[model samples]
Target: MIYKRLEFKNMAGQKVKITEIPVLDSRNPHYFLVHARLQALAAFIYNNPDSKTSYSFHDYLKRKMKWSDFIQLYRTEQYSHNA
Candidate 1:
């Protein structure tokens, strides 16, 4: 189940709107991959002084981090750049 929209600020200080937040399902086959991606995102946000969001990285993870969410956001940004 995807949640409501959320906002995040990237390292460049741009406000990125995320429209989907997938519920975490540990039983999913790709759970580990998703978990690792989320961890990497969290670490990047935490380590980069310029990266920020409405909530802290920890809070964001607890609230909205999931495989589908990450993949959706990634594809959206990627396609937007190319278009």
Candidate 2:
């Protein structure tokens, strides 16, 4: 897994730097699931400004998340906003 470093300004104007965005292999059976997870993570970061500096965000990405786990997190975040 080749990790890519990502640096961007969060919603709160804080610079969030992630150094472990995995470059998944296209031939992997779980490629789509992993891709979706990565997209969801990006959306999560964009939508929730507080996540910019959260320890959870930094730590969680360091360990690649399973598709189910990532989906659960994305859904939880969506529900929190709606509720």
Candidate 3:
């Protein structure tokens, strides 16, 4: 998600900078809106229940998403959750 209070370690075991994390959508390049990030993160978590903090949604969706469609998907999910 937005990782509001993040403090994760990177692959090299160095502390990760919050800026290194992206929201997995090219349209929302830098980061997704808080709520959208939350929903996407939730779906990812559900699908990968056994995983720990080893992967990011950005990593998973980078190739699966087109910039425009990704935005639409995220917005739709957000609306449904809050609707």
RMSD, every candidate, angstroms:
11.3, 13.1, 11.9
Q: What does candidate 3's lDDT look like per residue over 26-57, in tens digits?
A: 55543455346545655545444442654455
Candidate 1 structure quality by residue, lDDT tens digits, 14-45: 66543444444688664575557555764565
The lDDT of each candidate is 0.52, 0.59, 0.47
lDDT of 2 by residue, 2-58 (tens): 556667777778876655555657885556765665677767776688743533333
lDDT, candidate 3, equals 0.47
Candidate 1 ranges with C-alpha deviation above 4 Å: 4-20, 51-83
Instruction: List the candidate 3 regions with Cα displacement exceeding 4 Å.
Output: 1-19, 23-38, 46-48, 67-83
Q: How many backbone clashes can be found in candidate 2?
A: 0
| Clash numbers, per candidate | 0, 0, 1
Please report how far candidate 1 places residue 29 from its true position, in Å.
1.0
